[model samples]
Target: MGATMVEKILSSHALDRQLRAGDVVVASVDFAMVHDGRAGNALKMIEKMNAKALPFAHRAAFVVDHFSPPPNAEAANTHAAMRSFAAAHGARLYDVGSGICHQVLPEGGHFTCGDIVVGTDTHSTTYGAFNALGTGVEGTDLSAVLATGKAWFRVPETIRVELSGRLAPGVWAKDITLHMLRRLGAEGANYRALEYVGSAVEAMAIDDRMTLANHAAELGAKAAILEADAKTEAWLQAHGAAAPRPVRADADAHYAEVIGIDAGSLAPQVARPHHIDQAVSVAEAGTQRIDLALIGTCTNGRLDDLRQAAAVLRGKRIAPGVRMIVTPASRAIYLQALREGLIETLAQAGASVEPAGCGTCVGITGKLIAGDGEVIVSSANRNFKGRLGNPRAQIWIASSATVAASALTGVLTDPRGVAGGDWRVQ
Candidate 1:
């Protein structure tokens, strides 16, 4: 029988030995990424292991993004340690304002298609948008990879998700992913691979695809891969990455389950606080008041996402009582937004623009913490209790356009009801 994409990628990395679901193998990792949140532990593990040197230093990266600008002294110390480790190992290091690790790694041309990359962040699955087999691992596992350049894996079964029809106006990749979460639930695809295909997915831009893959972790996916085409090649080359080595699942590949979705019929989805799977249509969310409207993260902070939000807020102002913040995912994206006047547009709309980084998405920046009886609608991934620095503040997840529209009205307003420019992303 034919193999799924994950099976094929894992088998290729395992010396061309055919692999299937549940097969164990010690494969080589092409790249490893560690951020401030986990780099210290990884460095400590390496020291405890007493390894002579990091054999794969050149294939590794250290990024200080989660707590960029050293929100506190503790976070500053973590940055110091990351710098020391990067210099000692001769590895690449991205400092404050460089962006989230997931965006920084690829933008820095660290990995290419078909490469088996691992990171210390669950959102490492973001790299799967480039047709690479990227998954999350613990610091201990990352330490082993740095020391020996290898790691073990049990190939996961595949869940084939077929997306059909074009996305209606105001309905975008974020909404599609939120719908996936609502259908699959939090642990629905635990330790499994989700392979997305069909017309809707193909029509989506690379930025949109990143949003889909980045949030796959919320559905408990070990890896979420999208089929690559010319757009993938163009995006990699534009980012200075090496020529692509795209891979595809065979026509008759075995799948644990095959699910179909009609993108044309999907509406803007909102995931209630305390859980990502607690999703409902925007209309179903009712006219809930909001105090914060956040519009950036690794999940939806790309240039295109900013454009969509800008399209909604141009020549208008946010509600009188609402607070809006915009953060680009990377320095590159931030610069692009500036050149395109997206920054000024967002700022004029009463939104405070912060440096490009994880910012409030990880709660390390002390920006989006919620107070008692507060509600925040964010264009980010996770919304578990205390995810944004306070358990008392409720967080709702939605698309950037949705967040911007709600910000303009100070409630759970639908983007379709707001006057906006072209909502389609290139």
Candidate 2:
């Protein structure tokens, strides 16, 4: 079959194929995961169906993230529910503070190339990082995965984004992606797999590539993939997955649309919602005071991001009322930051550093209380309504530096003013 990454992955795991739009297939799902935020809902659905989460390798993962270290005994109760269910079901579990689910999956070798996966969270599209045909589903749909180890999908078309050039300082991969989405609108890539290529994409880190794939869903793309390279190989090695069998489309690859983004000339970009496509350049995303600023999540929540925030707050303090919640992506990152004094420096700067978890991003934790507050700078993906504390809150998505600078200044401040050399990921 003439193929793309999506097609190739589906064929490898083909339970069935739907060449036309009206066709539907219930493919065997490889991995089905749920985090604290949605685990309870998924479990309830499974219980209703009188079934276990799943019984297969890489199936039935319970991730304890969303509310880490337990906001209170009530939150602890929620964690208990996940633990009990996972144990009873014989599933692998990553407790809170272990790292966001996305960070932990590859580490545990739960994700692999040519795999078909699904999860409850929207950002689940992120698994495409390893060339897996992955996407998000509603908790009900996810609960079915837990029950039957399968879900349905209508094959999506493809969108090809050919990225070129090395990124300039302060112009990271996230910025380049937001620019494209803003131009295309939130549903720009809806029901399509986005394949990113070019020199800029070739040079990106595995984490950076993951970030691009992470947010492609924001533009309504079903999934994203890159031609696997040395980085993918190295990353897969660490994950204990075999050397990544790189996948790519043929020269005559089919795409519903073709777009080009030159990372070299791009600057920092931000997505202010109501929509992810409502993007603005870092320098042009006019300054606006924020009630709360958060750094971390499955999306930019890694050591590199923490280091950038630390660099911006090396000698600064967060403005009062502008609560800055900094969460490390994983326990390892938290410990490394602790040893490196990044955590200490962040706390000293009036930032509320929490255990590695999701907060203020997914709206389930670290809620803000400002009445009628708008525009919270965060590093998480998808700024949907009621996503972080308030349905009315405006979330301005940007790089870690912008989030930190905004926390320090109480206003959206560009990170361009901050020196980069002084930053260290360690």
User: Each model's TM-score?
Assistant: 0.98, 0.89
Each model's total of backbone clashes: 0, 0
For all the candidates, what are their Cα RMSDs to the real structure?
1.1, 2.9
- Model 2 C-alpha lDDT per residue in residues 297-382, reported as the tens digit of each score: 88888777887888888877788878778888888778988999999989999888777767556666755543465667888877
lDDT of 1 at 153: 98
Off by over 4 Å in 2: 15-23, 51-54, 71-75, 143-148, 318-322, 369-371, 391-393, 421-426
* 43-68 per-residue lDDT for model 1 (tens digits): 88888888787889778999988887
- lDDT (Cα) of model 2: 0.76
